[model samples]
Target: MWPDTTKVVLRQGPEVHIRPMVAADAEALHRFFLALPEEDRLFLEDDVTKPAFVQQLLAEQEAGRAFPVVAEASGEIVGYGVLYRPLFGWSTHVGRVRMAVARSFQRQGLGTAILRELVRKAQGLALDKLVAEVVEDQVGALRAFERLGFHREATLGNHVQDLSGKKRDLVLLANDVAHIWEHMEALVADFEPSAG
Candidate 1:
């Protein structure tokens, strides 16, 4: 389902290459996470800076339980996104997506590009819906997901704790795969230059 690589131009002008994560990326992935600020890492489910965590992610990909996409610019990883789904279970039709973009690339469409890749993968996998969890404090992330057609399905009060030990509400956002694809097409049309 993955091509060799593809390049995407950010809304703000930088170009990034998107590709599937490989085993050789373990060290680079570790470095990418380590570069993120501690505050940015707070919402992450795992300690991504650890090499073991990177290996685990690779293992999940190898085991076919996860699909990871990497975005690179200037030979460095600038964004990462993953789609995780159960192989067998009642929830097998649903995929959970997580994404992170480097601070320098935020707000420039890198996050959206990475997400677009994951959404495409989800469609290819025949997933019916995609869900994302965000802390209440992540207003930007919430808005971004909403723009992509996700709606808040539920909010779990004090469901997650930050690295600082502060409890925060966890907002569950979800959308059907078909609806998300429709919204994405609309976004593309809105951004395309008019031929006049």
Candidate 2:
């Protein structure tokens, strides 16, 4: 149902493992979220710190409603990518993406690798479009998705509230799935995490 597991070299030269999330990863996933700063997670809609939430995610994956993947560096979870496709709705033709990389691993091309895999899967499923909701001030995220060819579609004002009780706009970005699918390899190949 998902793409094959991959091993890629990070900018800093360490190897990271990327693969589809499994039921056994619940605990690791929780720890991963716990390791992230609140700033990196405040926009997440799912409360991933709870076991129940991970269980629900496994269920959703089994039922084919969701595809969530994880990235591990040095045997610890450092990244996550989730794509949701509604079975019945006006958005059946579209899949939404949610992803995060640990603060330490932010500039290492892990996010791009995850997104390329998500787009590849969406293409296999014949999805016409892919979308991502990024908070207005998340400059890194905005650039990551944009690098993959996703364009800004619209901005929803006050769409999300942060931990500080401040309102944040949601930047809706989208790409034509088929287009990305056709160009995925080049995007993946051109990924230069950084030699620093």
Candidate 3:
């Protein structure tokens, strides 16, 4: 089981609370998505701003199909990360990760911190590998994942379309969970809980 909630200090010197998203978070999660820029929402698989979409996400969590974590600051959701695992399939040992951070909070290590929490969850679940799909133009996301030890496994041509119906190449990055754990352990400094 994940912890009830924890706090981490970002590189920018602000602290954010991280916790597993609960069913009651549907409304706030929707608001968070609605606040995202169109460019940021373009590559998302689903229309997260829709209340129905948020409800579906909560249902997925209830059914154990998805595990989502959220970061809150000043009582508002600013970051989100989720792990998608197949319960029964040829690749049950693999989990797909997706993350998003508020535009105002970008470049402050919040994305990395959220990903770290998901990685810990993946480790606890004994997932062998974690994979992330990124559009070619999402350079920041690509770099963030790369910094965490993810390597390009494949790049599919025009595999996804943007909000404007523009087809874009999709890059798949994957890393062994154990390898990621080792990298995290070897990080120059760990983000420990903030002292109140």
Candidate 4:
């Protein structure tokens, strides 16, 4: 089972609460997606702006295949840590990660905060590997993944097209659990509630 709730201090120095996605958060998640920039939305596999995709995501979460969580600052949803694991597929042992942060919050350590939580969850699930794909133009996003030990594994040129009809390469990054876990353990420890 996923952990209850935790608060993280962003790299830019603000505390925000994060917790696993629940069915009731559908509306908030939808609003969060609609608030993101067009460039960020263009590369998503699903049109989250539509109610259908959000429903599908909720269904997937209900079935235990998806484990998405939202980060909230004050009273608004600011980001999410999207994680998934296939139940019976060939890649069942692998965890897939997708991160989204509010535009104003990007590059301020929110992405890293969300990712650290996801990595800790993956480790608990005993996953063998974690993977994330970033569009070539999203240099900051790629760097955020790298900060957590994700290394480039593959790059597919012209693999996806953006809204401008321009093709973008997909940068595939992977982190082997064993090698990255030691580094992430310290972070997991930091987020734990104090024993006081």
Candidate 5:
């Protein structure tokens, strides 16, 4: 059996709740993906309209190979986060995170809460590290990850080109769960404790 499941209770100022996504959530997930801005969509590769694609993602989550979480407010999916297994065998212990919160919900602490939950889930899966790739211009995303203990590891030059034919740099960030835990005390002290 795998190690204990890592579950992080997410609270968004007492209004929204975050939980693991299920197969039944495919349609909602699709809607969220479809609503993403073109710039944000460039970071993730997927065809939300395909049932096979959704099924594959759901299967991975059920098999302990990935995690798909959804943020809901009044029963509506407003944000989503995913942590998937690494591609290379040697890096199996590492996981990559992809997250997006609806534009209306951005800057309201939902992103931070979702990131914390991603880290919590990764640690629970016995993962050694969590990685995120953010476009260089996504200052908010970069800062969010940095505030959550992620450190910039590299910058992939011109990794993506938008519809406008403009190139963008992909900034890689990584966090060592063990190292973060070692400084948990100080970190907790820096932020006021709030119930999740």
Candidate 6:
């Protein structure tokens, strides 16, 4: 069973709280999306300008097909993370993760904590793999995923275009839970918590 809560310390920093996203969080999420810089927003394909998009996200959460969690710092939303499931039977066991943090919260360990929680959630679902498609220019994001045991599986060239109309490569990274646990025993030590 999945634990009701998962906790982690942001890279060499203080503890951060992670909890499931709720319907009430929609407005906050909308505000957060609006606050994101263009560079950061470029990676996401969501239409934040439309209210229906946010409603759809909340609806998806209610349907159990997706998991969205928000990282809180002193009761404020600092970042958000989501794991989306594939629809087809053949790919149902795979999940794709997306993460974003407020610029002020970046590098403060919020991203790491959010990712740790995501991995835990994926494991609870018995997923075989967790995948992430990161823009090539996002070196920090790539490194962060690597620290979480993700490995680059493929590179899709010109997968996206930036606001400036520059083509960007998409790096596909995947993490196999079983393989990661076997090869990095020490890393998973702290992540193991009693099921509650």
- Please identify model 4 stretches exceeding 4 Å from their true place: 185-196
Model 1, span 1-196: residue lDDT tens: 7656767777767789889999888888889999998777888888888899878888899899999989989989989999999999899999999999999999877777778788889999999999999998888889989988899999999999888889999999999999998888787566522211
TM-scores for all predictions = 0.94, 0.91, 0.94, 0.89, 0.79, 0.83
lDDT of 2 by residue, 11-101 (tens): 7787888889988888899898988888788777766667787788889899998999999887899999988899887889999999989
**Clashing residue pairs found in predicted model 6:** none
Model 6, position 55: C-alpha lDDT score: 86
Compose the digit string of candidate 4's lDDT tens values, residues 1-196.
6776877766666678889887888898899999999877778766778978778878988898788889998878999887888999799889999989999878666776777778778878889899998888887778878877889999999998887779989999999877667755665465433211
Residue 69 in candidate 3, Cα distance off native in Å: 0.7
Q: Give Cα-based local distance difference scores for all models.
A: 0.86, 0.84, 0.86, 0.81, 0.73, 0.76
Per-residue lDDT tens digits for candidate 6, residues 52-165, read 867887888878778899876666676889988866679989989999988877875567567767777788888888899999988888887887788999999998887677
Error of 4 at 190 (Å): 10
Q: Which residue pairs come into collision in candidate 5?
A: none
**lDDT by residue for model 5 (78-178), tens:** 88888887645899899899888888777666776666666677787788987898889888788877877789999999997755668989899988877
Model 1 lDDT, residue 189, Cα: 68
Clashes of 5: 0
Better of 1 and 4 by lDDT: 1
* Residue 194, model 6: Cα distance from true site in angstroms: 15
lDDT of 3 by residue, 38-120 (tens): 88888887888889987877888888889999999988999999998889979999999999999998877788778878888
Which residue ranges in model 6 land beyond 4 Å of their true spot? 6-15, 48-50, 179-196
The TM-score of candidate 1 is 0.94
Error of 6 at 60 (Å): 1.5
